[model samples]
Target chain A: MFGFVNANPKSLSEEEKAIYQAFYCGLCRELKKRGGQKCEILLNYDSVFLALLLSGLYEPPENSFSFKCAVHPLKNREAYENEFISYAADIDIILSYESLKDRVHDGGALAYKKLLSSLEEIYRSSAGKYEDKAKAAALCVKKTTEAEEEKVSDIDILSSFTGEMLSECFVRKKDEFSEKLFSCGFYLGKYIYLLDAYYDYLSDRKKHRFNPLHLMGFSNMSDMTDFTEPLLTAYISECVNAFEMLPVLTYSGIIRNILYSGVWSRFNIAKKRYLSKEQKK
Target chain B: MDPYKVLGVSRSDSDDDIKRAYRNLSRRYHPDANLNNPNKDAIEEKFKQINIAYDQIMNERKGGAGQSAGRGPGSSYGYRQAGFSDDSAFGGFSDAFRRNNERQQQSDGISPEMQAAVNYIRNGRSSEAMHALLEVPEYERNGTWFYLASVASQGMGNMANAQNFISRAIQLEPNNPTFREFSERLNNIGAGGWYETGRAAYGNPYGNNSSSSWCADLICMNLMCFCCRC
Candidate 1:
């Protein structure tokens, strides 16, 4: 939901990049198919990662064709068509609707209600199809709000809720690999929650919003940068270890790059920014 | 089953090669990773065989080496005999207690509260142990308190807190081999190797003994009800 699930483009090979782009556009196409054109606006990197992970785990057959869309009217872009992409698109709509509802509740935008109402039918259909996933997402949102209201200081507790929610999303069906999927999803979710808190620490502190890393005894962003890098690195290592256990036959290289070096690339950028801000201060 | 064949390793394979092969095969056949396979039962059976094969080979190798070196720490038979005596009471409290006691400075004897927490930990009452530790006065907290707190935190799956507390324990007693070794284990968690061995040796903090998983399931069930309230 935070849109932190991005692959390191530099680390990807040309073919992998092409595959990545095709999938990205493929999600966009599915979003339009399921939720209409307006839903395309809700496309996020997190759902793309979801599609990639599912595709890797399921090893479903893929088909792609070049097509020109509104975004790229002059050039033909390859769009992947697959079951996982469609599933991820539906999930994207559900998450977007939930986030919009949250925004409406926070009193930030009354217009968000109009968008929510427009997406209500699509959201309900998707939610009905994936009842367990929808329930998990709703529960995580509810618990996260409760934690924020209660001002919970423990990073693990706060992240665990998010982790469990993502675990549910990763589980397409209750199969033998469900436990590994849950473990991988849990750690990645925890890493994202912590990363979001770290990234938003400065603004959250200024706005008097709840930030778990800030509350976890970190005096400033610099201290947070130092502490979270190692912790996040450990989580990534766990994720990779679990990932390696899965019998992924195709696109394993791409997934490996994203998990191993891609995540670290994002972390370094954030660290550099934090360090620069500290130097200025 | 031939241990080498079961692990898909050659008879001439080195220990590291055997270990690598086992790790790969186990990951592939692990029940969690093979749920959708039609041969789930077969895979599970094979996984058990692989585990048994690895253990047999390692034990045989250890036995041979132990005989050459005489009776000592390297002797697997001697070690197991020693372990049997320690495992008999409170699920092997003698070993853990003795190790902790050895690290205790001459003037810094184990407190009753510390002893009670250790007992709770041994009995799988991690929450109770955590509660007892929390009740200790701030000034009275020492390396032992922090070390035990790390164990409690690890049991709760709060690795961040576990890492912090264990690091504090190491800082307080820099030369304590047990503390340093535990710290290294915490640091290398999920990377396998020593971490796995340490977890098996010292006992799993997040094992079936903890009720946290049940609590989580209950909370999730209630939350599902709440979400479905139309």
Candidate 2:
């Protein structure tokens, strides 16, 4: 669902890179187990992190299975069996479905449009299984699409909508720890929206498309990095704070490094790179 | 909750130790550091608790000393009380966004150019302020330029010139407390105002007795120009 991860090559240390790959593979295994091979492509780091978090939080029923992916032919793969991973898989389907629907409505190109259309049945079935998450994701995407169409200026409203949807996913099994997880999701949702809005700004401008920052009349994206950096800093801090709440599962170390060092620094450096590229152009 | 214990201090710890403890704890549980930690809810709750504990202990100690001195007594303690139910301070300050129409209304029918000048002043963009101020209509140029000049002069550390420009600001905004404060602060640093301690205006507040009337005359001359226009 988060296309930005692939587009931006945020460098990571060897250890972090290995953890990320393992998580990515782990997510692939999860999607396949939950919804079959068709859902494997729906796997991404965003959902992987969510899976890892849920695993850490709930201690999933068991950590079981091994396999190999086309991406890593010779390597052994591990799949975790748990409620959180299952939930993450469901969410991935819901988000991907809604995002696809948005793209179709927004006039996405042929292959992408077709792929999303083909996945609808599977998405609908998964949505049926996880009704609340599906509903929330659908509602958030709908609101975001509507705001884009209407050209709304309060970017936080749409960002919060996305945040609330993710937050809702965690809030269902409410407890002291989940509440912290919800808060983390809330700010991270805002961070994601800001970054996506920023990365898409120039292209959106060229295509006569809507960007949240553009709606606010911020001419330069870096100008927003100052405003956005604090949110990112807060996002990382929340992740750190959430760490204490985590029950310390199998992949806790992997998740922590990805969150604290990888995602944090990537977001921190992205604006600088984006600005310099804009300057060069 | 023992406030001293909350701050990791003994009851006999010096004021400096207490301050240091508060600073260290504040940095550790600061909302910025733990943005999305799964335990953010607990951290925030703990943070609020720590803040309250520290404040209570510090205030009790300060109050005890102040009571002994009997100086500035009976005044309301402005320090934020922890027992208060309001969490707005803990949530962080909100910058209220006034809608464009409301912003225009607040500018008193000022042209967009003049409004931009004022915004530049508030944002510390003096060059931009000058650029925008120049765009004001000729009829309104005097007031706009003077206000912009006051902000620019103040930013540039030319207090005398700043006072001159501020007097012009007073002519335009007689009842504006902010402008009055600016004028008052400038006057205090020069001839003498409330900020001057143990010296009357006539006694040469700058400590050079002969300098009094000269500085006072400069202020009087500036105010006269402003009064003449008013």
lDDT of 1 by residue, B108-146 (tens): 887788888877666545567788998889999998899
lDDT of residue A13 for candidate 2: 43
Every model: Cα RMSD to truth: 12.2, 22.2
Q: Each candidate's lDDT (Cα)? A: 0.67, 0.55
Question: Number of clashes in every candidate structure?
Answer: 4, 13
The TM-score that candidate 2 achieves is 0.53
lDDT of 1 by residue, A1-281 (tens): 76666666554678988888788889988987886666766777778888998897776789989997664577788989999999998888877787788777766454567667878999998999898888888888899889988988888778878777777787787654565566567777878888888777777879777787766686777777768876775555545544544456467767765665554444556677788888999
Badly placed stretches (over 4 Å) of model 2 are A3-21, A34-36, A219-221, A234-252, A264-272, A278-281, B1-230
Question: Could you say which candidate leads in DockQ?
Answer: 1
Q: Which portions of model 1 show Cα errors greater than 4 Å?
A: A216-220, A264-266, B1-4, B7-145, B155-157, B189-230
What does candidate 2's lDDT look like per residue over B1-230, in tens digits?
77777778898877657656766676688677799898998888877877677655644553342211000111122323311022131111012112322543667555777667656544444456657766766677554357556655543223334556878877975765555654554444333322122112112111122112112442354345434533
Candidate 1 has an lDDT of 0.67
